[model samples]
Target: MTKAHFDDLKALVVDDNAHMRELLHALLNVLGIREVVEAADGEAGYAALAQYQPDFILTDLAMQPVDGIEFTRRVRLSPDTPNPFVPIIMVSGHTERNRVEAARDAGVTEMLAKPITTQSLFARIAEIVEHPRAFVRCDSYFGPDRRRRHGDSHSGPWLRFDDSAPDVVTI
Candidate 1:
């Protein structure tokens, strides 16, 4: 799926800041996404997601009532949503390892920093559409495959054997 073919795709922008929401709404328009829904927080975002079956979701990490992580968890784990496998891209100013890990654990498909660029935004969109990650389901987790790299099974110092794959670890 290319940008040219995304004119009909809808994107839901969830941000608590008015300015950031406006900025992201404009950027999505510039990206040829005409059908867009905006939300002030994760609670509103969840409502919007249920109201509008968007092709993808762009959300902020920190929010009141319902944060991005919680919203994503609901979207991925909730059985009442319109679609549980909808793509979600988390946008936040805090890019710390813990934040990123939390977002990933909550079922985010991608992470974008606060000051987003048109190129970077488009790249993430393209990556999600062009090279979508496979869906994974476990007893306590459900979302895109967590591992970004794969290779032959091996145990050595060069290859970190202790990883997400081949283990029953908590996300």
Candidate 2:
């Protein structure tokens, strides 16, 4: 597969730790993303979004006052959000299933465990670019479709309420 070019993309890095921000900045630079904005925490990150209007966001999961989950939620749900559709990749040391599920529920496009590698980071970015998921809006959620796999084949009964069953007799 051909390497994807990210020279034109702008990114926002949000982490309370300065060193983590620096590391991510370096990685992003190496990936050819020259325009990067950094925020020390989620609150700052939220403000920066309006000011910088980044094409994507990489955020740490834990922070004071506001964490990455809250950050992603605001970006996706806030009325004044600069770009609700912007892709959000949450990077965190908390790899526990509950934490990961929380991030997913908050609308993160992808999650990368801490101790990130160049290859893994690149793969996530490429996945976002190559297979962008369609956004879904409902009473409780407004984010990318939660379901990752899509096909007509199913081992059990049809689950989607929108899909009509061929064997059902209409009244």
Candidate 3:
């Protein structure tokens, strides 16, 4: 991406750890994102959104009062918030299958594991800018389209007792 792509873009970095927040600040700065807002926890992040909306959000999954999932939920579902469709990247050291799934279900645009590299970090940001997902609102979901691709199997095809997979259309 060009400097024009990220220059002057506002971003929020929410993490309880001071070092992580600083590290994110540096990463965002390298991307030419000068306006980086920070919060110690999800509640502060929510309040910051009200005070001023950012183009994107980078939040931790675990925190006191409110976690990243709850923060994302509010942004996607709460009427008190200004925008429900902000691009959010959930960052955490936890890269387990369950944690990643939780991040996806929480409406995050992307999930980045901790100790983020320059290349991976930029790649994630670039993906967000280049490919934006359309928002979806349903009784059980209200956020970006959860499906990443037409053929992505969020849940594996149905299996019979004989272990034969069902012919299921992914899309």
Candidate 4:
């Protein structure tokens, strides 16, 4: 039997390496997902999330400036804006037990070893998107259809949309 597909959802693939991003982007498209966005690094990932609010996020752990771990922490802890608790699948070359443990502790929904295959990626995506709260706390965070709550703190990562402070929005 074939599994149910969520063809309407959008996804963000974050990685500094151009080839990796391209690979994942292609894989996602092959999965019957058409709306896939790309981010060069954690900063770009956050920006894409704020602007697009993709249904899911696939990010690489190792990157310059703000790494995946830090990015996850900031996304989880940020206040003001309601976060979607989006499922964040973090990928890395370090597959040691301790490293995997660390990634889990840092708030990643799932961890995958490098040299990602289509089977593994699709399987994990199915698992994650199937569960209502697979990666994030959806009710607490906002999605495309979800409405924004009053008093929701938007003062965290993703973007610096400070109600009090002003900053530039860059690509």
Query: How high is each candidate's TM-score?
Result: 0.86, 0.87, 0.84, 0.72
For residue 4, give model 1's deviation from the true position in Å.
Answer: 9.9
Tens-place lDDT per residue, model 4, 9-127, is: 78999898999999999888887789999998888788888888788889998888878877776667567323537778888887888877666766677778888777888877876
Candidate 4 global lDDT: 0.72
**Tens-digit lDDT track of model 3 for 20-126:** 99998998997678899999999999999888678889999999989999999889888787788889999888899998887788788898888888788788888
Off by over 4 Å in 2: 1-5, 152-171
Candidate 1 runs further than 4 Å off: 1-4, 152-171
Comparing 2 and 3 by lDDT, which wins? 2
Regions of candidate 3 where Cα sits further than 4 Å from its true position = 1-5, 151-171
- Among all candidates shown, the one with the greatest lDDT: 2
Which wins on lDDT, candidate 3 or candidate 4?
3
Clashes of each: 0, 0, 0, 9
What would the per-residue lDDT of candidate 1 be over residues 104-123, giving only the tens digit for each residue? 99899999897888888889
Ten residues in sequence with the least summed lDDT for candidate 4: 142-151
Task: Find the candidate with the highest TM-score and give its number.
Answer: 2
lDDT minimum window of 10 residues, candidate 2: 150-159
The lDDT for every candidate, in the order shown, is 0.88, 0.89, 0.85, 0.72
| Cα TM-score of candidate 2 | 0.87
Give me the displacement of residue 144 in model 1, in angstroms: 0.4
